[model samples]
Target: MIEKQSLPSAPILIESIRSIGYSFETAIADLIDNSISAKATRIDILSIPNEEPYIIIFDNGNGMNKVELEEAMRLGSKNPNEVREENDLGRFGLGLKSASLSQCRNLTVVSKKDGKLSAFSWNLDYVIERNSWSILEYSEEEIMQLENIELFKDVETGTYVLLKKFDKIQASTLEINKTITEKMSSTIDHLALVFHRYLDDGVEIYVNNRKIESIDPFLTKNKATQAKRTQEIKIGESIIKVKPYILPHYNKLSEDDLKKVGGKEDLRKNQGFYIYRNKRLIIWGTWFRLSRQDELSKLARVMVEIPNSLDDVWGIDIKKSTANIPDIIKKNLYSCIEESVFTSKEVYRYRGRKENNSEKYNYVWDRIKTRDGYEYRINRDLPQIQLLSKNFDKDVLIEFERLLKNIEKSFPTNTVYLDVADGKLKNDSEMSAEEIDELIMAFEDSLNKCQELGLNVIEFYEQIIKTEPYCNNEKLKELMKEKIKKYE
Candidate 1:
């Protein structure tokens, strides 16, 4: 038999995964994941930036014991290739170690369970000094030092991770703290929505003493009264329930409103889909490959919730803040999301008519291409009398005969034309001067009626005459001259 030799202890490679690669946002998100998994109903995140910036993540959840605390600090010790329970929030179990290390050189976890308090800490400098992986157990005196910390007082049972010597935070000064607070305020607002049901309890998440407010991108609170139709669909075995909401038109939204129902305005950067894994938000913004189209840009936020077991399907990384939706789910999601977009677009179009008077002229109005010039198209087959003159106005119709008479002398062209098949104008017939005046008066009266009905007759007529000039007949000048003299 060959002699079996034991291999030397493998040196702990210190350079492989340093704690500086992860962004501050991703690191904080990871810490929150642990809290959520612990069944924390309330979570408080506190950051004090100064000469020595520090971060504290406190949660009201089942705390860990001494042994569990020690094991939790050992990197890569998580049981591999093992199936987790349905309620388990951990997938790879590297979140706490990796996320904590990525943000600070020193990490301390304090917890109370079974009527006992225990704590564990990992000091990177100390590990590098000894060139080994070791967890420092908190002494009775050290625990006393932490007990005085405000966040730890009055907590029945929970775990708190204190990140100090924040060498990884991009901004560590007091000035930077202001900016971080602003950014975190927006981030927490979105988080509240991701785990709304959990946060709505008496437990509150305070950022700098201000409670976080949930901003529902779907406008579910106001949607009941404003939505025209609401539908829900149960998809696949996951029972992924999709709630389709059709929002009110743009006009219905308050003039001072910053959010529009079913609109993507709420999903950009700080406001999009808040992906939650086991009641913790892991991602924000649109999932890769899914973009906000113009029609859907206003209503793009669609929150997707998955149990921790589906972490592999979502490509959840160790940071627990970014994820990629699998192709299987994306296939079904595309159709549902598309339908929601189409519904919103139709509602916008229909409600626009009911709310705005200008919508009625959408078809006939010549959208002036330039201040000095205009381009017009008569899409309808109706006879049109477009006036390219600068003086076109509603009051011009009051002196319609006078204006036509002036045109007969100055331009000597038929200011009006007859569309033999169209109802816009009457057919021209041989008549005495008196009869021509009556006809002109009747036509002018009809146009004034259109104006009263809020129709843009001037714009409509401008388009028609520009497309089909009134001088279709060569004798149109003579007819105009006769009508002008008779009117005078």
Candidate 2:
């Protein structure tokens, strides 16, 4: 028979778990996950940055009883392999302990339920001093002595997690208030982004008495944002939703609008795939190595929504900060990349027409590279250009052709290429509500002209629907159908 040996000392094991990689922001986020899983509608974080700073997070969640509280403090409280509730945001069960202990030496959790309060704590200093695994149960009087513990005095049910002796966050010799203020800014932004969907659904998060607001990366509410048709992919029992968005041209956005979607990073760097697990953003700003990041595709962002059930399929990690897109979805996404990229380029190329008086040009100029170097050619068959050419005299036409050739020769192809490669290309576009309205108005006028020319309504509909601008709009096609039926 083999004899079982006890694990390492309690202090050694506890300290080891604390060393797991968790930044100040991520650690707080992990605690917030617990608050959410507890069905908390309101979460308040209070950090007092004195010499002996304490970070307190209190949530109006389903507070645990004495039995449940003890169980919750146990290491590996729940198996990662075990099935969990659909809304539960935890895995490995070590987040509460490891995340809290990473920054502080003492972690105290106080709960109020059924008009009674219970408090418990895990102190690394106590463990090291006693050399034993033990939990320190606090008396109601003792708990009340702690700063901000009075918050739960009158509440019916809620949980408060207090982190004391913030060694990691206060490591620097800098002034405590300044350090805390600087870190709070990033923490606020991260919490707003990670819990954006929750915030939208009416969950309130307050830090230092200030409420946190959600920042929508999709810009879905903006009238100028272009949405591609949604696609769905199945991975076993789970269905992953995919929706692509082309953000409005920068020129159309005010300064405040820019900061709301872009945050502190340049909007270009914030592009690519945004993975949301249960409507909370986890992995983002990546293409999963399927394609390179291009300036042209900066306006292109793909939203991939996955339920918590697919956590294993997507390789969700302990921190829940990163994930891998499954192989099955990769093929479909790659196949659609070309079309998405083309739409993105069109958004980039169409820049200056947002202004009311700006002249709109729809010239498609192809730049070709041969062994001799580069050449540019305008598509002379374009309807607008062809119509203009009919009004030119012979000598005037010769001069026009010479001018087009001169413009092509001076195209600055290499300069443009280098600028795009260096991420210096200005991402402004001519697309706006005005442009779409003008397009529809022009199509309606053209239909009236064709009617006066004695063209058959059906023939006119068939030809016009296949032409520029009209072909791009499905609603316009339906409108044309209505007009043709009215005329008949």
Candidate 3:
């Protein structure tokens, strides 16, 4: 018996995987990968805003021939593991199709190579309706028209991709254009950072006519800052380098300045471990649970570089924009992440009032005499107290007397003795004085101790005296009155 092999079904939209789930940023990154693979020295991303604003990515590279262009349209056609030139940035070949289709319904690629030009278009709606792998071939007139397009006019050899029918662009009514510009600006800044060496080598990237600038995630531009430290581990034949970074303290960054460092406020966005495949960024967040401490959030810009060979090890997906860090990497990452967290915490240790030694304690001393001149006096000794009365206002004196009576009732003399025996008094009170002279001397000594310990002392005495605490014993009243009279 003879058996027939069935042909593969035409590609269909996986109803489970709606195109909306893929962010516009990821789609753009995927298109840029193709540009890099074509050996494009210069790339221009133009955003045309009309009824249907389209995105155009033009690159001056070794353009594709008719056959190559046809093959490129086929999804999942290229071998991901095949070795290519060092500069090639393609892997799994699905990026062009997946990335483009994920954003818009129409994707058109026009190219010129070896004096011949060709074009191809894939419309998701057309494909879904026809249920076939049909592409629009470039007619002579169409090819001629595309040649005059400004993006390709001066190019000796290159390719251009136009994404139209943008169904995926975010629609926010508040400053929509400004929002898009800011997002693209930040995305380009990051892309440039990821490919700084490439851009430095005479390759230019422009976003809406403005040149994209490279921003070092490590802030290496500051000559005084320490250089980023790198740790490398061998996963099979490929060497994965983890560059850990400790950002400057919060106070060191100015308000307007931190805003320039995209997503600086969010801890999740701040400390990042960018994953690169084939010299292109595949991931730009944390490596799962490798680092999740609140303190480590500030050091959120660390990047991890992985060669293309280890894409499988990293579980890189077809879109080349997301990946899973393997157990091998996870194990190595734990130590590197812990060390980074420790360093970041140490740097920001003095962040708030925790470092203010002077305000740690405040003491206030007040001496007052009554109008009757009965000679009764009051001496208050407390640690870290803020004195509310200097002249001893009647209302403040009443509140003080109420607080003292409450303390005496709730915490009797026996309780105080127990507290002192248990060492709790060390935290609650200063030294105790029995006789009136002794109490005065002790209060002065405690004030000196507070000063010695670098505490704030606010003295409020000899301002005003109204009534004095009544004591039955004549001897005690005389001593108190004498002390009050001396201070007054």
Candidate 4:
């Protein structure tokens, strides 16, 4: 037989709830979910720079009446097991209270409906002193006296979540206003991404009077971004939509496009899956253990869409920032990942050369996969390489093949990958006049080698011009043709 025990003290429980691992961004995001669920078209986030720092999130949403406001303020007001509306962004009803108290000691809510206003507050200090789950309800006149209430006069029906005594943010800070401003900027980007679909659907969000713009991870607007095939998977009763995208090679992007997708983070780090629940981006830039992130696959990004019904199936956490891929869907996801990486690698290896000269040129190196693993070998099928092998002596051909293999074996791919990630790699497309001269010299050297091997000059010149590195430089190819005319 079990003995019944009394509940924990209100202060102790509130303290535990407030420390439940919420970053400032996610906490603010959870509150925004409430506004979105209320069908808010316009939401404003304000970080008032008073001596005592406070934050106000005001939304022009359908306001709650006195009873609904009381129910909304209560902890665990809605059971997670209960079926909610299809578009509701909330699960557990603890978001309003828990998210606000996570960052502040005092949480006050003022709501207006049909020309009547009601207010309620949860003060941790007051609850701790009283040793009970006590709430302070303010009169309409008292609510009007609040610091930011003057800004909410125009809204006839809406809700204001005012956070005061910002113990988490303002603690031990001399420049509190600057810290809040920085936090608001982060909030701006987080909301822009999380509520991007809603923003596209006419929902407006403003941070300190500045409008927030969506950051589309797919780069769908860019011409060079290749949209690959999409596959649909059914797990039990849920259907998951998967669309894979290979972003443009960095060289194909303009400076503005580079900054758009690249931002401060390396573009390589931005590869992998972007998980969305009901069109809201929850987690992104993850491979979910399907594959490793590498230089060749840096351009690959897959978008996975799941409905709220699959929350439990996907293992969505309270923070909504992480999700685990289900075993039932892993097989299909892996297949898609393989195809995406292959496409990404083609773009990465040739760097748009294949697109421009698809039928004319063959790369110097071929990527070979065997039971042993991946290896690189020189492409002996290139006409120039084959012609030289046929005309040259056996010893010379053997030496040349050995040199090619050694160069391929000793290629510092790992170091090059690190350099690419660190943004240390220079743009190969932009060639100075001196670089062009160097390219012409390399082309002339190849021509001279073919002649010394007793190959027909015209045939060798035509073959070499269509080969890798040379095929990519049309200007150098034309100049080399001029030099070959001089040889004749």
My TM-score estimates for the predictions, one after another, are 0.63, 0.74, 0.66, 0.75
Compose the digit string of candidate 3's lDDT tens values, residues 317-434. 7666568877877888767765565545444543442355333322232212233111212235332133333335889888987886565446343454345435576552222235
Which candidate leads in TM-score?
4
Q: Write the per-residue lDDT of candidate 4 for residues 1-488, one digit (tens) a residue.
A: 99998888899999999987888899999989889888888999988888887889999999888888988888888987677777777877788988889989999998888887888999999999999999988987798799778756888789999998988777757788898888888888788877878888899988888899887777788977878777999877778999999888888887776775765357888889988888778888888888888776888999999988888888877667778888888889988887787668767776554567656777787767554234668898886677667778999999998998899889876566546656799867666779889878866776777778776778777777887677778787788889899768
| Global lDDT of each candidate | 0.57, 0.78, 0.62, 0.82
lDDT by residue (tens digit), candidate 2, 106-212:
99998877777788899999999999888899887897897897788656799999988777656774676677777778999999988888999999999999999
Model 4 — which ten-residue stretch has the worst lDDT? 367-376
TM-score leaderboard ranking:
4, 2, 3, 1
Model 2 residue runs over 4 Å out of place are 263-265, 352-488
TM-score of 2: 0.74
Worst window of 10 by summed lDDT in candidate 3 = 461-470
Worst 10 residues of 2 by lDDT: 353-362
Model 3 residue 95 CA deviation in Å: 1.1
Candidate 3 Cα errors over 4 Å, as ranges: 1-20, 168-202, 254-257, 350-488
The better-scoring model by TM-score among 2 and 4 is: 4
Residue 43, candidate 2: alpha-carbon lDDT: 95
RMSD of each: 13.6, 13.5, 14.8, 9.5
Clashes of each: 9, 3, 7, 0
